[model samples]
Target: MTTEKLFPVNGVELCAETFGDPGDPAVLLIHGGTASMLWWDAAFCAKLAGYGRYVIRYDQRDTGRSTTYPVGEPPYAMSDLATDAVGLLDALGVERAHVVAQSMSGGIGLIIGVDHAPRVASLTFVSTSPGGDDLPPPAGGLPHISTPDWGDPTAVEEYVVRSIEAESAGVFDEEAARALVRADMARAANYEAVMTNHYSMNFDEPKGGSFGELTMPVLVVHGDQDPYFPPAHAEALQDAVPDGRLVLIKGAGHGIPEPLWDEFLAALAEHTESS
Candidate 1:
């Protein structure tokens, strides 16, 4: 896998990494809130690469080795995030790509599908809520988040790992969890910048027109036991997109399970190839 590097886009730089040959089909992976692209396991990316897919996973503006501004709230809107994705594709000279994202990134994917339809091939949403008021609110709602000391970067990092461990519970692999935490924390630019982006951005509204307009294949994968967004959220997404389908994993939570990685990868491969 290629290491993370800064790509200039929209007057800022986004940190991104790549795998597989450039000649293959493209799959762009977007991570969740406060999470770097590291959340998408390297082994999973390698699996896609082996399948003749050119996979690209990248950090959002504030979360990883990308641009960060600690002094104030983020000036960019959710649309800007969507623009960043398309911009990244442009930077790579990719005309179109399959967008695969998790959690908040899923909402962003929907935006891209709606506003920049020509640039997207297909969409895969994992453990995420649907955009817009057409569907009922997500089941179980969003889980309550505990704030850590924003001034102390170490505390912020610890909180991130601890929170993931708590939510993951039974399905989590200790070694893998630690490795991801190390990758994310080591590369995080600033906790204040993360907080700024998190609080300032609007996640509920569908700023990129209607998801119904996306005629391409859409896939929603969610865990039956997801604390943040329940299975019904996946159902909502499926309902919203005419060509969308849902996959409800058993015994999994908000995070993907290590043992079930094969199942997740298999489904993703099938969906990608179908598009």
Candidate 2:
């Protein structure tokens, strides 16, 4: 069974869930921007736990049941988010954990891997890139990421579905996407804050140290068909890190598709166990 709790970390209450035995190696799963822990679906966590890993997924501030701020006025920066991830491990009494991060949270993982190196056992970055001017640009611009109406859940859900369609390279599942969006909408303290606050975060400074500085076991997972941060980004990231390995998921885009979970899980298990 999954155990859910609210942890007070970095001066905020973060809703977190854990699976499997605590004594097992811990894997911290960080979702993308404007996403809650729900993005790392429960079934997926259970499957990872089945591999004898202590899996952890949490709702970051301004997402799901965590803390919220006034819309269009966030008081924190990307560095704060990175700090929160480390603080969470402190609260959980986990000395070190294998960090599995998706999309925007990959930067957070990079920060932890570099700045708070002692707290991370390994890093598995998914659907993200190491920021560099020379890397190839995305296939196209991201969809205009604005939720039209917070009061209308249907409208918000439709926007999410459309956004996924724009970003995904695999087949789109309209029914599943709407269901997930509705649950997020129903559980959020402020849905508008969840969707818009991330954009307003202060990113004035760079995130983490250089990719070459990461000393831990590093795995780069990317979709060959990713529109945002194409496959080349993954190659560049892998090449930058010493002894880094890359797993290119065929037919996947910016997100991990349900049909490809096993492939991801297998790679993740081997990486964490070896680390």
Candidate 3:
């Protein structure tokens, strides 16, 4: 694997990791809210690379090793976040690639597919909901991952560790879990511009109408037990996209990359390869 430093939109520097041959078809993996690229397990990325894909995973702004908030400007909108993805691809000289995203990142991916259609070859949405008034909020008081407060170092560290543990309780490998928390802490220590991005930018419109303009293939993967975005949301995505297909993973939850690693990899490989 190789790591590349890229400057996407808004002059934000993004830390991107790549696997497989650069000459192969590319698959961009966009993580969920408050999640770093670490959310996409290394084993899963390797598996996708094994399927002859050039897999790329990057930290969105304010999440990992990426640029954060500006000094005076307000938080960025979801459209800006989507534009960031496009800018990253442009910076990396990637004309078009497959996109796989989860949760909030899924909404961003939908925007990319709609607004930047030529740049997206295929889309794989995992454990994501169509945002808007129709989509219900998460049951608990889960902080929106996109707008974290990195002001208090100690508190941020503790929050990162606890959040990772709580979310990946029984699913993640113990060492992997520890490493993820540590990575988050390290990133938070250096970056404190978390709250500069708007969480409600895309919440205004349902993800339905956007898909009407997307011509690329789409695959919706959701866990039957997904707490945040239940199976119904996946069904809604399927209903919206004329060519989209939904796959329900048994006994899996919102964290697909953790519990449903193999299944997720298989689905992605099959979907990205087929016509």
Candidate 4:
């Protein structure tokens, strides 16, 4: 995309970035829980653009530079989040686009595929499960990290520590990752607390039946080292979604690390093309 802007949709303004030419086929990239579009990373977006795609990534509400619900619960359901994505496309004058949603955001993509199929060309889920709010937890409980208050000097360090624990082999650049998280935190309000709510928020049962009903192509990407939603979750989704395929990244975790970025990028490009 040639420009980045704050586009209003669904009663709020979303901070969106575009790469490559608009006339090219569009691919909307939705980041994971509590993450801004920055998680998609500049290099990653450029690579997708090199594939001749108009890649659009945005900061979802309550994260990044987008609208925030600083107090209490957000006044929306999981499906409403999906509606926001469709509304964004409508605002941007995009008739249809492929969707690559990661983690909890993928739940929104699933809803869009079911409820707003005409707006989506294909669906790709990364590190997520179709089970939505009710997926089983891993054997080990989530690590207990003391998240510092938002904007505290120690906040960046906290972010890095948690990330190091999540990435399979700690292959990422520590200083760069810290800087990114720090910037994202400043753009957000009450970042850590807000994310806690986002992750734990309950959802009503999904309206559609199993994912097998979706007619469009689907792809499931999971990291073998992902401790959050394991490889089995990806396999299950692949089996459930009709005409779906799965790819497992050998050294990746729930988060995309530098080492697996190339493989992930290539696989995603191929998946979108075939779809």
Best candidate, TM-score: 2
lDDT of candidate model 4 versus the reference = 0.78
Candidate 3 has its poorest 10 consecutive residues by lDDT at 195-204
Candidate 1 RMSD to the correct structure: 2.7
Worst 10 residues of 4 by lDDT: 163-172
Query: lDDT, candidate 3, residue 167?
Result: 50
For all candidates, the clash counts are: 0, 0, 2, 3
* Candidate 2 vs candidate 3, lDDT winner: 2
lDDT of 1 by residue, 154-248 (tens): 67766766678666636876666777776776777776676457556755545556767776788888888877676777788788788788888
C-alpha lDDT of residue 275 in model 1: 33
Query: Which residue pairs come into collision in candidate 4?
Result: 1-18, 1-19, 1-20
lDDT of 3 by residue, 41-142 (tens): 677888889999988888886777776655334366676777788887887778898988788778788888887888888998888876556866554755
Better by TM-score, candidate 4 or 2: 2
lDDT of 3: 0.72
TM-scores, each model vs. reference: 0.89, 0.94, 0.82, 0.90
Model 3 misplaced regions, further than 4 Å: 8-10, 70-74, 132-155, 165-175, 189-192, 195-209
Tell me which of candidates 2 and 3 scores higher on TM-score: 2
Over the stretch 173-265, how does candidate 4's per-residue lDDT look in tens digits? 767677777777667766754466566555643487548768788988888877777777788889889989898988788867776788888
